[model samples]
Target: MFRPLAVVLLLVSTEPAAAAGLDAASINDAAPPSVKLPGPHQVNASVARLEIMLDRAHFSPGEIDGKLGENARKAMIAFAGANGLSFDKAVTADLWSKLAASSDGAAIVNYTIAEADVKGPFLEKLPPKMESMKDLPALGYRSPREALAEKFHMSEELLQALNPGQKFDKAGDTIAVANVLDAGNPAPVARVEVDKTRQTLSTFDAAGKLVAFYPATVGSAEKPTPSGTLKVTAINKNPTYRYNPDYKFKGVKSKRPFTIKPGPNNPVGSMWINLSAEGYGIHGTPDPAKVSKAESHGCVRLTNWDAGRVAAGLAKGTPVTFVESAR
Candidate 1:
């Protein structure tokens, strides 16, 4: 059946790391380190700043979580390449200076929660099964914190870690958040490329210059992505998902066709870019953390914000090339 994309769960730590300088002041003032350090992912001020900078430059680092994870590394590498810098999995000093020079702003800023942020007809709990979601009024966020975290392109864990003891349900409560809301609109895209090997999507201008880059999740082994060239047919915002029984997706036992309502938590997230290939398109996912780390059933998957940004710069008949190797 034409099922909604699979959702992957990611576990993140919410423990506050005051000793590691995870506060707003430290994050805002953090400068890039001259040398790359080897260690496990942890709550780090410098990494947080670097993520914010890369995100602001339109090379999204996926959900900013104060760690130099794979998504962040991919964004850094793409940004380095686009800027004509040599980066070999290490955050070089030259790359850091270039990123800082391009995206000039504080990494973290204080934001007052608005009434609309808490006034949600939020679901108390979202059903795990897709069939169970058909009867729900809307697949909205489960909590105010989830809504706020997605609004600022941050992980829920990072949001909690940044503002400890502060429940996000209260309106007017000021909290520290990543400064990623003002990335600005990218230039019109002339073409799009999805590299399966690198798990990245890049939009290019008419002159063949990179305009924006995003980490994406291509198709999995069971359902490999389409090869060769395709064209964009349509773009839908807050798309309603319709299921067909022929696909017979795993974990879905229903033999009949079904339809799910639209929301950020919907199987397709907030945006859907229909492709020439039937039932195979580039769409957004509910789990931003799994954008590139996880597998997709067949179509390409990007973060909700990244999908929207790409949609804005694209029109009907835009060329979309899918390749197994990096270009």
Candidate 2:
């Protein structure tokens, strides 16, 4: 196992620049962050190990891609705040020492792919348009590779890059991968904060301790997010998305209403925490990297895992407040 002695952490803005007119289908091609980043695009062993440490601490950095991108900064900011460390400035030896003490494991590990992992219940391909998704059996992951990538908090491309010439579609295949932890089972929530300006979702426990933090795509200028507080009207898991023509979604030519079945790839991803603002909810997204860096059709969108955890922490009448960023 490769160990990192010290990491020069430059405070980079986790918020990426917004692309032009981000509709539902525009999941890939995220705009780079405005801040001058310290690291190059190449994968860094030190950075990957840092990602594992942060994830184990519960400040998820989305997919553990080796690049020190916006999601990693988000995790860093949250972790820094929780521990009373400076969110700004470089990560010195002392900071790395604290992080190293937080977790006890190798950044990478070996796991055997089970028969259930390569099961054929996966979707071969998903339609380009959300309307076309209505006719499909369900909005599941397009392939076993995608499922495995999500399971380990990795990008499909990174997974392939890490294991060249290895087929992820087989059972009983042991592979070296990131030792990422699952977003722990959700805890009870006292309050939820949806910061549209900062594009973040944070929740506080009954004692007002920050329990979770996630990058999110909030309402856009065309469809502005509602102001003030809203109550959680419903918590629907494995939710079905009903697209009404009244919403006037860009590029959606369907005048008639359509129902898209539930799965991780669904437009609303997997979980739906319905808000008091009708037709508006905090939902999940197929594109985890695009959250907080893209525009939405009048909804707050978190990464699927983050959204699931947020939903788990909330009840039928939990309060969700929309406001300015904490910074």
| lDDT (Cα, tens digit) per residue for candidate 2, span 119-231 | 86778777889878999888988787888887787777666665666778889898767676543654689999888776778788998888767778899988888989999
Overall lDDT per candidate, in order of appearance: 0.83, 0.72
TM per candidate = 0.92, 0.85
Q: How far does residue 71 in candidate 1 sit from its true spot (Å)?
A: 0.8
* Candidate 2 ranges beyond 4 A from true positions: 1-40
lDDT of 2: 0.72
The local lDDT score (0 to 100) that residue 117 gets in candidate 1 is 98
Error of 2 at 200 (Å): 0.8
Clashes of each: 4, 1
Q: Model 1 TM-score?
A: 0.92
lDDT of each residue in 29-122, candidate 1, tens digit only: 7666534452335667777788889888999888888876778777877787788776653566788889888786788889999999999989
lDDT of 2 at 251: 84
